[model samples]
Target: MSDSPLFQPFDHPKLKTRNRIVMAPMTRKFSPGGVPGANVADYYRRRGEGGVGLILSEGVGIRRNGSRPDKAVPNFFGDDALAGWQAVVDAVKPTGACFAPQFWHVGARPDDTTRNLPDAPIDSPSGMPWPGKTVAEPMTEAAIADTIAAYAEAAANAKALGCNAVEIHGAHGYLIDQFLWDATNQRDDGWNGPTLKERARFAAEVVKAMRAATGPDFAILMRISQDKSPDGSIRLANTPAELEQLVTTLADAGVDMLHCSGARFSRREFEGSDLSFAGWVKKLSGLATIAVGTVGLDVPAKSKLFDSFGPGELDEVERRLDAGEFDLVAVGRALLADPDWANKVRDGRIDELIGFDAKYMTKLH
Candidate 1:
């Protein structure tokens, strides 16, 4: 057991992880009409039953218009969706593993069709260009408060439904991310502009609301990234000092764990620090952290990335895990390709592992 870093248990104050391996949130377009059925519930239950320590469900939209272009990817609103998610909870909890839903709101990234929903309102931090040229109308104060309330309600709903944890989808240039980045958020309001801490207010409120809703014992993980999607640009604090300050602020905002999302987990985030961004975050914030990217797979989980194998200890994955650099490691593409990857690694069945195929992105099995 001492020879394999992957088999070790990550014991935490609130969240008890049975293994170092975690199935990071990977979206599967199978929940039609924003409502997940038995198929979606069984999809995660299979992994939980297969022996993953923790299972983070794919992004589930918080608001009506925050859904993706695909008809799948479940939502947390409406009775049907809630009932569907509860079914998922009931199925996976018996596995003796922890589960969480990645709460999300796409903000300004909604398609025109979704924006045209009868009663759904389209709003973001400030009027700026998103993935498409559709400029978002600035959110009114009432709208902002309402969105925060929605997050709290969602967190409460998740707990009521029997999920063990709740992870805020603040990464990858999404809604919360739009507020974090100065480029996407060109607002002169008190919540944005001038000071860095000022811009962090929105995310902080979300975290605070989630914490209040979920309570102290229930785990609250915040996923944050330096990189932005749709253009491969970085939007986080460029320097180590700024990074520390940002992390400290987030820690104070009630984040129990910080899941740092990057293209690679082992690469350094700053010029002088030997630690990666995940390492730095853990160091400064004193919170449990998870490092995610291309872990134990054949390719980075993206639509456009060239195919390449993700094997072995690249830079410091194994070393960091062994050294307690981060509490967990999120394997997205790897698990998507092989749900039993964790069991196989623990049992030393690496030879039986299959390479990741992009086609599985749409199909669960």
Candidate 2:
């Protein structure tokens, strides 16, 4: 095991890693035809070979047409896509790196720019992307059941592909998040409730269905954020107490890990407690959590909405990691810009670590 706290080995029932550094799930629309091929597998294999503890792959669409506007993003469905993912898993296995795919759907944020079905209704709890402008109808009971089963099938696919874990992209204004936030999920049905825990039913149902399909060995990692990607002012939980309740619901729903998303992993979540988002989630729910933000790049908090980021937080992240603030630290743009981020940190090559340039965001590298 590595001596550094951040570099220490991690072992969970569903996943294990050589270190505590996880390459955060990032969106790179490089998979043309929605099928990850040799290039895609190589991209991840390089990171695994470089020393990333766990690799949560880029968001993969579960819908037939895919939920994202960019058709280049990979999909978890279809025989071709699954075969492509098999190659990815096969490539990563030799590196001994645990991996997972972030199951995703864009919900009402339909990509009208892409080749979408003519007049096909966008799938959302209320069919409202934002506060107003209802572009489609709310999800019917049948549709809701179908979406839940779709998630379950996707989780099954991950397991069949030998994925160590599977993640539900319940954050950043996506489909699952649409069910989470009140502004989007305006349904008065069972999916919506008077309390935070009750309102969390849709997400919990998805979790339950996934757990049933994947069984005990496949770990479910639920990624959640306080605010949507476009709206930081809106939060899933107004108070830390509510945050605790919401997180507990997922834990009770059988989530093995909480990929707590916040602006920064070091910033205090509330006024009283100095604990970060991951800290509060872990403390309140007693589930393992991954802390993520701008660990290598000095970005700004909420710079890209709920994706809070900024400089001078990496040292704080390290301190908190040593102090047990979070179990693992996820590096997003940092790892995207520099694949050797883990190796550099492991070898005390901090001085040589390159700063993130904005240009790297447009390229897969």
Candidate 3:
């Protein structure tokens, strides 16, 4: 354990942590009426107490009419929700862990029939939810401007709530990713383009707005992925040069870190190279990166998402981290199963570590 790089401290200009473990943001839908309660606070506090270096809260909806599909998804706006998040921050701060709220917007979901407000408009770059599927109208320029401002407001709110940083949910086929994907974003306007880098205009604007709202010193992290949700074969950038164009655009827009999500962190991203997705991003953009996906799980090849799996060894993960492939490792289901995962691993208590069970997703521990 002493030689493992997972326990090493991570330091950056805007963010610092005692170790390189980050709690990946997973949707729990525990909040009622868009407001998080005491149970949510306690759940996060336990992770901090368990020795996680950084804890990124579950995806919280931004201030938009159709930002989320379910009523229970927490919101980062409004008085009651803001107060609820304040409690969460208060609870996690004392345990010596840095916190960040992952601001999100679902954006024209294809299978989201359970909307909190049935009549609320679903905003999308173009009206397409998936490739060759159109259900709504394209977002107007004015609506796009308002949505960008809402993201800025959320960042300001996170800073006011005493969060060390804020993460933008720009991955997983969400709103931001919608604009970045060519199949979804079919607009002929400036937001759409023939190349991946050109399609990143909307995300670049959002990052600039958040940076302006939070000031220079506040840290901003954006989660990105080559694969989109509901479809893993979708590759946003097929080559390293294309990926460099996309990430360098965000870096210039003031992204402090890039949380690169993949199906498996160890898999090679491109041919003729051993670098993973996170590794490629860090090497291309020269920015801090967090590598996630199936960490601590013995997932079988071709297994569906969220399938039950036993605990897997971290020897390969540790090897990658020590080799400077990525800055941090994000453990999702493993931490959800046992909040003491970080502490147990730190003390070399691998045998005592609990295995991930699908039932753990039903309720917060």
Candidate whose lDDT is highest: 3
Where's the lowest-lDDT run of ten residues in candidate 1? 306-315
Model 3 TM-score, 2 decimals = 0.97
Error of 2 at 285 (Å): 0.8
Model 3 clashing residue pairs (backbone):
none
The order of the candidates by lDDT, greatest first, is 3, 2, 1
**Residue-wise C-alpha lDDT for candidate 3, range 70-185, written one tens digit per residue:** 89999999999999999999999999999999998988888758667778788899878799888789999989999999999999999999999999999989899999988899
Lowest lDDT 10-residue stretch of candidate 3: 300-309
Assess the local accuracy of residue 225 in candidate 3 as a C-alpha lDDT between 0 and 100: 92
TM-score attained by model 1 = 0.93
Evaluate residue 329 in candidate 3 and report its C-alpha lDDT on the 0 to 100 scale.
91
Compute the lDDT of residue 328 as modeled in candidate 2: 91
Model 1 CA deviation exceeding 4 Å by range? 1-3, 67-69, 110-119, 131-134, 298-315
lDDT of 1 by residue, 1-365 (tens): 33667667877877887877778887776888889999888888888877788899898888646434456768887899999999999999898678999988777764455542435566578755363355657888998898898888889999999888889988887788888888778777777975557778899998898888878888888898888775556657877667776777888998889999887778778887668778988987899899987887544444555344355453357788778787788888777778777777777677887667777776877
Please write out the lDDT profile of model 2 over residues 280-329, one tens digit for every residue: 88899999899987677765423232343457455677788888778898
Per-candidate local distance difference test:
0.78, 0.82, 0.91
- Model 3 ranges with Cα > 4 A deviation: 298-304, 307-311
Estimate the TM-score of every prediction: 0.93, 0.94, 0.97
